[model samples]
Target: MDTVKQSLKEASIFTHSQERPFKCSDCGSNFKRAADLREHERIHTEERPFSCSHCTKTFRTSSNLRQHQRVHTGERPFTCSVCGKGFTQLSSLLKHKVTHTQERPFKCSDCGRGFKSSGELMSHKRFHTAEGLFTCSVCGKGFNRSSHLQTHQRVHRFKSSSNLRKHHRVHTKEKPFPCSVCGKGFTQLSSLLKHKSTHTQERAFQCTDCGTGFESSHELLIHQRVHTGERPFSCSHCTKRFKRLSTLRIHQRVHTGEKPFPCSVCGKGFTQSSSLLRHNVTHTKERPFKCSD
Candidate 1:
């Protein structure tokens, strides 16, 4: 009974007092209670005492661990009264409530970016700080996030990772997507799907100039360029022009002296994979190609 009265007296004293006696040695942040200061110190020490039972993930606090556990258990204790949308945390529910009013209470001082919640503002503020900045080693360019930096580092040509990966396939000749009909490999899934349409005899796109049917509109457009003599892709080193981008890339290798494809047997390199594949057959004595008499 005396301990309960003493705790209540201490709580009352804390409310009336403006000074925070407990101070964190790491960040120099003051806290009203010693327990709060101990929790704050975990940020500097990188200590995560609380762990999730379902996964290998750990948290500094038990509350954070509980919130993460809700993801695995599919538990949403906190729900918005307006939309009845369930959320794992009360903070998420409070943020969802502002969506109903369309209110942006938190605003960024640096960029003037407005956010519905303070958590979003805090994340946005990290973009202006060095702690959250991701620098590209190639160009010495800085990005707010690692994903943005990775996308930017794709020879500074592609806008997205998927687009860069597709373009990389042109040089690497990495055909992951395969057509089950003819067992032919393609770089893109869309190309594989288009190849499958040829097996089905489904040609939706037709060239107006040549009257030749193609599996896709893109293929039809490229075919039309042959009849029109429209060389869209041009060589950087020479006055040579090509109908396709792949051809232009191959032509550029002539000036650059780039041999990407190398023979595994003799370590000799070639500009094209077709040249390396033909050279590979010389070792095996495979005479698949012969003049018909």
Candidate 2:
């Protein structure tokens, strides 16, 4: 009881004096007491001493651990008065309230685009700068975002001998994901869900620029690139670029002399599928186009 009283008295004295005696050497953050400075130093060291009782998750601060407990408990104390929506954190509730007001305080200097948060505006600025901080070591592909580079690197792993063994299931006609509705089977769960959407004819994601609807947000992003003229995929050999990575890969094959497509009738190889299609038509002796007088 005396220890607790002494600590409370020190805290009161620190608050009254408004003096921060302890300072962090790394970030230059000032703390009222030595204990607070110790807690702040853990952030630089990436130390998580505070562990959650319910899960395996750990936090650097006790306050963060307490806030994370709300995830398991589903306890949302912060509520928005406008929409009556609840949030676990007060900061989240404050951010949500901005949507009700339709006010975008953060603006991009390059494109004059508005964002609800400063973080979103900062992310948007990277597109204008074309900041390629992350690069794939295998194909030397550059990406503005680290997450995009990580996803692109998976393609290199998929081409490996070990991954090729697992990929042989595609040629062997293997279907892992089965649909409950129509009893249709797909190689992937995402493919199964996309096939299910065909029956519903549901296009949930809408493009803000063209007002075109798509089944997924990924499809919408690709469609938006047409309006934005953002060609992120570039060829390593030449100055040629493409809107999609698949197209860029096809373009790179021209430089690499990779002829995957072959004419089945004549057994002649071609660099592109379109060239193979044209050669196949020669065997049929059918002209697709006729000159008009």
Candidate 3:
């Protein structure tokens, strides 16, 4: 295989030397091989010549076509040795292998945080840069991440003034609605009403399979997902799924390393607001929960 070795050696030399002899006439983007340049030029022309035999889908390159064919064949040739997880592409397998080792090759210069991939590190770096890639048209508040901006925009979608005020209590840490039975405070009147029902032993919502009773319809729905074994919320980054949307949203912070809830005293960040509340008690030495003997 002298021919194969010679081709590999030439490719190595070209990569190291950064010698791109072939240049595109349209964009002036350089490529080492004429075929690669031609394939790239198809982006400008919108030419997808390579058609899949199984389906009507087409790709610009034969390599992409072969990769697409694996979907129909269910051929996952690239398998992780550690986890035994299979991937259609070698690149995806390589990315998955990093998770097993817990090795983060990419590091953020600003916060000194590490990430498994360059894409994750780039997303993390944007937090320090103050670049507003996503902006709210209503309040004009800028957010670096699109997800954070989308979450912020939900505040503006409140139909009633009372609903908007109830939501604002979360940020202000004000609980005006107090339960008459247990004297427990809640941000929203609906939550306070739900708490009052629990004291009265009101089983308004009952499960079909299980005899478990919930005070609210939302609690019943969440409980039903347990028996059904259905995870409706899934992480966009990975294959990890969750029963609740709130849990999935919190899990996404693990990938993004986004700690929105921070302790005021220690400045320690947490994925959940409840975790931050728990941590805040340590600073005040407040034991809110007690057992009566």
Largest lDDT belongs to which candidate?
Answer: 3
TM-score, predicted candidate 1 vs. hidden true structure:
0.45
lDDT of 2 by residue, 214-286 (tens): 9987888889999999999988886777899878877775554445575576444565788888778878869
Worst 10-residue lDDT window, candidate 3 = 262-271
Clashing pairs in 2: none
- Selected candidate, larger TM-score, 2 vs 3: 3
Q: Give the C-alpha miss distance for residue 156 in model 1, angstroms.
A: 6.1
Which residue ranges in model 1 land beyond 4 Å of their true spot? 1-7, 108-134, 143-151, 156-293
Kindly indicate the candidate among 1 and 2 with the higher TM-score: 1
TM-score of each: 0.45, 0.44, 0.59
The residue-by-residue lDDT of candidate 3 on 86-124, one tens digit each, is 999999998888877758888888877777776666666
Angstrom error at residue 87, model 3: 2.7
Once all C-alphas are superposed, what RMSD does model 1 give against the true structure?
23.2
Residue-level lDDT of model 1, residues 46-65, one tens digit each, is: 99999888878889998889
Error of 2 at 74 (Å): 0.3
What is the alpha-carbon lDDT for the whole of candidate 3? 0.84
Alpha-carbon RMSD, each predicted model: 23.2, 21.4, 7.8
Q: Residue 43: error of model 2 in Å?
A: 3.0
Report every candidate's CA lDDT. Answer: 0.80, 0.79, 0.84
